[model samples]
Target: MDMYTFPFDTQTCTLTLKSSGYSDKELIFADVNNQQSLTTESQQNQTMGEWELLNINASTTQPSNLVFSQHCITYQITIRRKPMLYIINLIFPVFCFLVLDVASFFMNASESEKLGLKVTLLLSISVLLLILNDKLPSTASQMPLIGKST
Candidate 1:
């Protein structure tokens, strides 16, 4: 759940299947032909909204304890976000605004016009920051790199 990496981040989620009432002797969990439980169709349906499935690893485990042991099938699913959405919606616009601000300095406008242009650009950037603020959680432990850059 680290958002510090933001658009470049990859998340690994674990899905464990186990029966609480059933022990390993009563119920066993095994992958077909010792292969991953994920089907070909699931692999093909990799893209889930903004996330792109990267890898899936499945394993069976039997926890050793004084009590009855239960069979668990764990799947580690790795997915990376499709950064295009963030790039287009957030980063690109900010970059363009920065470029415009910098280029405004070279414009052959009067001092008053330049000041007004700078003020306008500053307001535009403030509005953009406000929009970004709404998208990110205020309770985050650390600010995201995107936020810092913006």
Candidate 2:
């Protein structure tokens, strides 16, 4: 087939393939470039390719260093919601707070020990938050997420 075009746009010409699978299914992104033994999965799903033109995110102008003879950009795309980072940052601390809240029950009707326990737990969780912050890298070193010491 002839992919004839005068001005090529990388962002426009390139097609994006997105697929969703069960948690167990291995989501793999394969770049079908050059001559190589086609993967068994590809061979099986040959008729069910997952390439799609970036119609919604179409490019306004032609991209630079355009290259042809290439198509079918496959990516294991997974739908995710925002607030993931915020939730993560708060999950541990929030969990600790919840635990402390329950611990408040240990306090008497009106006593110093009860107040002390609550303060102590809050301080402990404060330290934990700092540790978590330090553990997470400032920049994204790898995909998915940065490795946590745990």
Candidate 3:
């Protein structure tokens, strides 16, 4: 899995089914009634936690080697993360803090009080950064855009 795009990323996974002992002549995989082998109704009713199912494509392949040929049924599934959760839990709070930080300049207060409020907001933003770090993979090839912004 690639984490460069992170919370807003779309992922495609492939699943292949084949019988090692049976050759293409002996075993065949086909969709019933020329319809999708997997039912969308069943997939629609199921929830994938943070990921939402976007598309499913099914195809058949016959790979021949020196020994024998095997029939394989492959399913390619595309899913996207439900970003609303991250936006609410991570982004919204940081945005609110920034707004407050800007508003603090307009408040009628002592210089020390404004400094203290700014410091508090900075600390709060750092805490949110830690939370974001925990959610991202440690060994990602490139940092996500959201992470880079933070």
Least well predicted 10-residue stretch by lDDT in candidate 1: 32-41
What TM-score would you give candidate 2 relative to the actual structure? Answer: 0.33
lDDT of each: 0.78, 0.44, 0.79
For 1-150, candidate 1 gives per-residue lDDT tens digits of 767888888889999998999877888676644334364546686655878777777888778873988877888888888888778878898899999899997988755788888989999989988887776446556777876745
lDDT of 1: 0.78
TM-score of 1: 0.80
TM-score of structure candidate 3: 0.79
lDDT of 2 by residue, 14-130 (tens): 335533331113443444443223333344544422232222222122224434222223332221223345456756567768887897897686787887887888788778778
Model 3 misplaced stretches (Cα beyond 4 Å): 2-5, 25-28, 32-39, 107-109, 137-139
Residue 116 lDDT (model 3): 86
Candidate number achieving the greatest TM-score relative to the actual structure? 1
How high is each candidate's TM-score?
Answer: 0.80, 0.33, 0.79
